[model samples]
Target: MDEEILVKKLKARDQKVFQDFVNEYKDKLFRLAMGFVHDSFLAEDIVQDVFVKLWQNIDSWELGNAKLSTWLYKVTVNHALNVVRSKKKTSNVVDISQFVRESDDGGIEIQIPDNEKNPHNKLENKELAGILRKAINTLPKKQRIAFVLRQYQNMSSKEIAEVMDLSVSNVDVIIHRAKKNLQKQILKLMK
Candidate 1:
């Protein structure tokens, strides 16, 4: 079904709508949380908590003003941020030992694909995706959240500002810094 119909059903208090919503976005939400937490298990737990929060608050959710996906994105971002913050309080530096591991053949390669548009560039693109994911993990909390919402989640600056509870200019600044940081990290990794 179309997003509009699914959301309308949800707003109409359909019980099964929440299940459909979870099924539709669970993987994406989990990936998003993992982007921040960097631990698959913790990320999965966070995604579940986010959905529970959504289900509990669905009645008060104003599906009239925004797309359900947008709301979901906001919720996902906020939940991921909360996880990041809480973990920070309890653990200052999260270990990156999990994200980095040697392959049977060799170590990690950090390189950008030259011909990204080529149909046969899938392998190179996958390598580049890995490098990009690594680069994202090194970003600071605000920059990471801003970049993820803007780039991966396909959210505009205004929407990110709303999700992160920051001003539009703050979102813009964070994204700019994030891009610069990403570039520096990519270059450092390539060296």
Candidate 2:
């Protein structure tokens, strides 16, 4: 079924369709939540809470001129920012690009450390991922979202703009600044 039809069915209060919607998006939503919250347990809870909120507000929903996924992404990002902001200190950091697709099952999987590898190389790889994640975490909200959607989620600038409710030019600027900031941070780390 096409997404539009599925969404329409959901809007019409078809309970089965809602279940299908959940099945279709649960993994993607969980990944997105985990990307932002950087905690597996908390991210799972966040995804579930967001879905419950979506169901409760379904009756009031008016699917204006946006894709369902984009709307969902927007809601997810907002929820994540709220969660992070509520923290008094110690923001969460995540290495989103680590979740790469594997050929065996099409599952999102990061590279696992080889048991036979020397400790030093393993430690170095761990340090690199950490440094990269730190640089990404320090990005401003808009830039971070734009960069993550673009780089990690493989979303086009147009899709990111819709998800973020930003102009295409603004998205371009965010990407530019995000790359610049990441470069500067990487250089700082290397020094």
Candidate 3:
């Protein structure tokens, strides 16, 4: 469905449109949230909240200059940052593992190739993904967001710049630095 049509339906309070919107964007929004919040549960909550807010403010959406997706990304980033900020303010030190259900099916699985098919390659790839994630975590907030949007979401520098409300050149610089930092981190780990 075209975005303009979706927005029109959404503004008209069409339930089918709402469901379609969720089905289309939820996973991507969740992934983006996960890149910021780390915890799967928290990420899910943030995505849910973004949708709720979208529905609440549907009538107010200008839909003049930016695309609906750009609005959604901006909202996701703001809410995710708010969660991080609130958590920081509280300074809670609870061990997240205690809250996590460790049942075999219950965690966020980084899906590599099935180990049974190629155990060695699967293991190596999983290790590399872990290294990459850790390197991403070490980046400053802006750089991490820029890198995630560009790499994981396959967004163009211009798209990322709009999402982050930064200049295109600045987004490019941040992504460049993020790659260099990740490389350095990976090299150090290789030692």
Worst 10 residues of 3 by lDDT: 89-98
Model 3 ranges with Cα > 4 A deviation: 88-138, 183-191
Q: Which residue pairs does candidate 1 place in steric collision?
A: none
Q: Candidate 3's residue-wise lDDT over 1-191, tens digit each?
A: 88788888999999998998899899989888876666678889999999999999999887685888888888897787678666532111222232234458776433444556764664455455445555566678888889878765789998998888899999889999988987876566533
Instruction: Report the C-alpha lDDT of model 1 over 38-74, residue by residue, as the tens digit.
Output: 6677878888888888777766765466666667777
- With a 3 Å backbone cut-off (N, CA, C), the pairs that clash in candidate 2 are none
lDDT of 3 at 31: 84
Candidate models: Cα lDDT each: 0.71, 0.72, 0.75
Give the winner by TM-score.
2
Question: TM-scores for all candidates?
Answer: 0.58, 0.70, 0.69
Cα shift from native, residue 51, model 1 (Å): 1.5
| lDDT against true structure, model 1 | 0.71
Ranking by TM-score: 2, 3, 1
